[model samples]
Target: MKPRVSILAALLLVSVCAKAQDVNVEVLQRDLDHPWSLAFLPDNKSILITLRDGELKRWTPGEGLSAPIIGVPKVWAKGQGGLLDVVLAPDFAQSRRVWLSFSEAGKDGKAGTAVGYGRLSEDTKRLENFTVVFRQSPKLSTGNHFGGRMVFDGKGYLYIALGENNQRPTAQDLDKHQGKLIRLTDQGAVPGDNPFVNQPGAKPEIWAYGIRNPQGMAMNPWSGALWLNEHGPRGGDEINIPERGKNYGWPIATWGVNYSGLAIPEAKGGKVAGTEQPIFYWQHSPAISGMAFYNADTFPQWKNKLFIGALKDKNVIAMTVNGDRVNEDGRLMTSHKQRIRDVRVGPDGYLYVLTDESDGQLLKVSPKR
Candidate 1:
């Protein structure tokens, strides 16, 4: 049976230099169970999607969604811990290798983020020889804040973003894996030139530290810089370009107050002495997630712009990037009324988005004729 297609005409309108821009949103697939992330296959027509409930699925046009691919690692599947992100290997066309990041369980109910890889069987129904590559150290008791976003850098090194597991002070600890960005080789070995590889008490895989719960990460196509967005307590969501050995103050310095409406005691102010500042931050956080850069010719007006998913704000933010600085251009799909989970630029040059809901949807955005 063919999945129903819904056309939402002119769902986005943005004024650009006295001209009105119209966007068309087409529903591609629906009824996903809290879809977390998506990556396009080499063919560009097929997609791999990860559900928060620990299922992996493939979607192809006309064929609808495929059955759950077998051999996914067991996930905690509680709170924020579950199957989170998926990406194909840099040599996926010849390798058939797929990588995954998820929350893995430990003794006494503790859990932490883990990364693994496996080859997709020729039948596309199972994973073969799946091997876990990395696991966070000192698994904590909390289930929330398992930052499971992963992206490969220009040099093919895999970068993994981690959360503090609701344990705030750990964000400042170099000895802990929580609240850190890690860089490792494809097989999960620590890169020798990493900033902390020679440091006495730091994890050799640590690329940067003091992150909160980063849910969005992407490599800028133009500059080859790595950028990420993370959640804040009550406000102060941030977009940062992480550099080697840099510190991004979390509990120690922030623009957000606690969820209880009280100020965070450890935080002195928005800027601390040694921590790097965000290029852009939201005073009232939108709960940002996945991100992508628009370098496609399909929408010339959106060329070189960055698009980020907004869960709380229920819109996709378009930002203009100038060197290390970013400016908000506009918001799209504001009237859609769904939590945007992930955003990616398709191989065909259109924008693809995933809505985070039990009845979530995959949407394709293009210029309205």
Candidate 2:
């Protein structure tokens, strides 16, 4: 082929790929007021969503939004503190029980991730009993970066991802519960089957440690492998698949450097013997927050793609996944880019996205054409 003709063909290929990548985004009920998290009931008739400022609302098809679920825990509501993820118990249809994670204020105004349980009133008008079950030990003063995404594995164990809380040194310490993924019973005790259960002086509650600000975390439907995305200091954002009892190189080992361009020692040699390496990493820091694997039939073509929301870029990126490899695909950059908070697949197979402003909206994805 001639040089000019080859160049033209290459350009045409690029245009075609760009046109194939598109997602139609729409505002499905704005004025959400910083809605931070969401979960769907078994019935698929309603979605239970939480506002950072302590109100929980239910959205149904014809009824719009019912009044907020009252009696939620008291929250700090300043900085990165507020009501967080709301998950239904595995047997919630019969139990009517729900689990919530929030930053509860302790003595001296300290805040920590406290997992609590609540009962949905008959009319779905309120929450009752509302008991605090598990709380992170030694709550800190800086109320930020509570990695509160919760999931229940098929083994009936609850997996909780925790943030480093800006306390870098503690990330490698076994004494601290922050900066770790913990395996706990529904009643909040460290299960005997956990990886670190027999380690001495180490918290048995820890399933995996050495995480920084894990903003987005999820489990793959096919592999059931736990995957997560965490923010880096300035660059070095990472997507990791942690193994039980493994220490992920956080401040100690990362591809990112300091925000001011100062050199921090590499967390470790990239191929260190026992350490877990991130499956994917972004050197420029996408400021990733929430993540979910697409298994819904609504977008059958997008099945198994990983969706992650970027705060700094103000875009929702869909990536193609093949085993551990991911390549970027489509993106929906909305005008309401107030820091995309979380992205999860709804029961109906649509995408539900959250934003991070004092008054943010819950946006939905629809067909563009």
Candidate 3:
């Protein structure tokens, strides 16, 4: 069944007030139940979507939405845990393999982030020989802050972002996998050259540590480096280009205060030894989620800009990147007032976003012709 968009009257007023003129938003699909992520298929017209309720479905331009695909692994659908990011393999054309990150539930109601990959069936009805390749160590009882975004660098390695599971101090612990970025081979094996492979107690998969709850990951097209965006407590959301064997100083030193309106004890000095600083940070947190770079011919004016989804302001934040420092350009789609969950530049050279809500939507943004 095709669902129609029901634009609210207040949204119409906001459109008139905001003057968003560069691109116009078209509601492609509506009535989604808290959709989390989307990945454009190789064909450019088809996309695979994941819902927080643990359903995997495919959408095409002509056929609308297909029935939920089969062979999804068991997910813990608690507070902030569920089916999350979906990404295609770097060599998906020949391999037909796709990757997924979700909250893997364990015994005693504990759960943690996990990464898995499998081949799509010929008919697109099921996943064949699905396997959970990696699971975060030291599973916690908290249900929030599962940083499940994944990005492939076009090199042989794939990177997965994991949160600290609401246990702040754990971000600094190398003995545990919490609050770290990990790199793995296409088949989930640890790369021999990974920074901590020789460390006796450190996990060999860890590429960088001391992140809080990162929800966005992307490879910079020009620099060939990995970048991430993570949520802060009260403020101080950060954008960092994670380096191998570096500490990002999460609970130990953050610009944000505690949620109880108190200062974080470890962050008193604001600078810690041997920790890296963020390339950019938000004094007023936007609750940033998805990220993408605009390098498409469709919108020549938006080229070389980094686009991030802002949940707190219910809009898409655009920034101009000069080398590493970023300056806020403007906001997009604030008229819709929806929590933007994920953002991507489709193979067709257009921007696509997912709204995070019970009655969410998939929207396509294109230059106004």
Choose the strongest candidate by lDDT. Answer: 1
Of the candidates numbered 1 and 3, which has the greater lDDT value?
1
> Which of 2 and 3 is ahead in lDDT?
3
lDDT of 2 by residue, 1-369 (tens): 111112233334324422334567766666777777888877777888888888889988777777877878888787887888888888787778888988878787777787888888778887889998678776773877777888787677888888877777677888777888878987667788888788787878889988888888788887888887888777767788777888887767766677778865545533355566676666566688888899878877878788888888777777778876665566665455568888988877778888876667777875454
- Candidate 3 residue 161 C-alpha distance from true site, Å: 0.4
lDDT of 1: 0.87
* TM-score of model 2 (CA atoms): 0.90
Candidate 3 on 206-265: residue-level lDDT in tens? 999999999888988878888899998887788899999999999887777888879987
Ranking by lDDT: 1, 3, 2
Query: Candidates' lDDT values, in order?
Result: 0.87, 0.76, 0.85
Candidate 1: stretches off by over 4 Å: 1-21
Number of colliding residue pairs in each model: 0, 3, 0
Model 2: ten consecutive residues of lowest lDDT: 1-10
User: What C-alpha lDDT does candidate 2 achieve relative to the native structure?
Assistant: 0.76
Candidate 1 TM-score, true structure as reference: 0.93
What TM-score, computed on C-alpha atoms, does each candidate reach? 0.93, 0.90, 0.93
Candidate 2 C-alpha error for residue 367, in Å: 4.4
Instruction: Kindly report which residue stretches of model 3 are placed more than 4 angstroms away from their true locations once superposed.
Output: 1-22
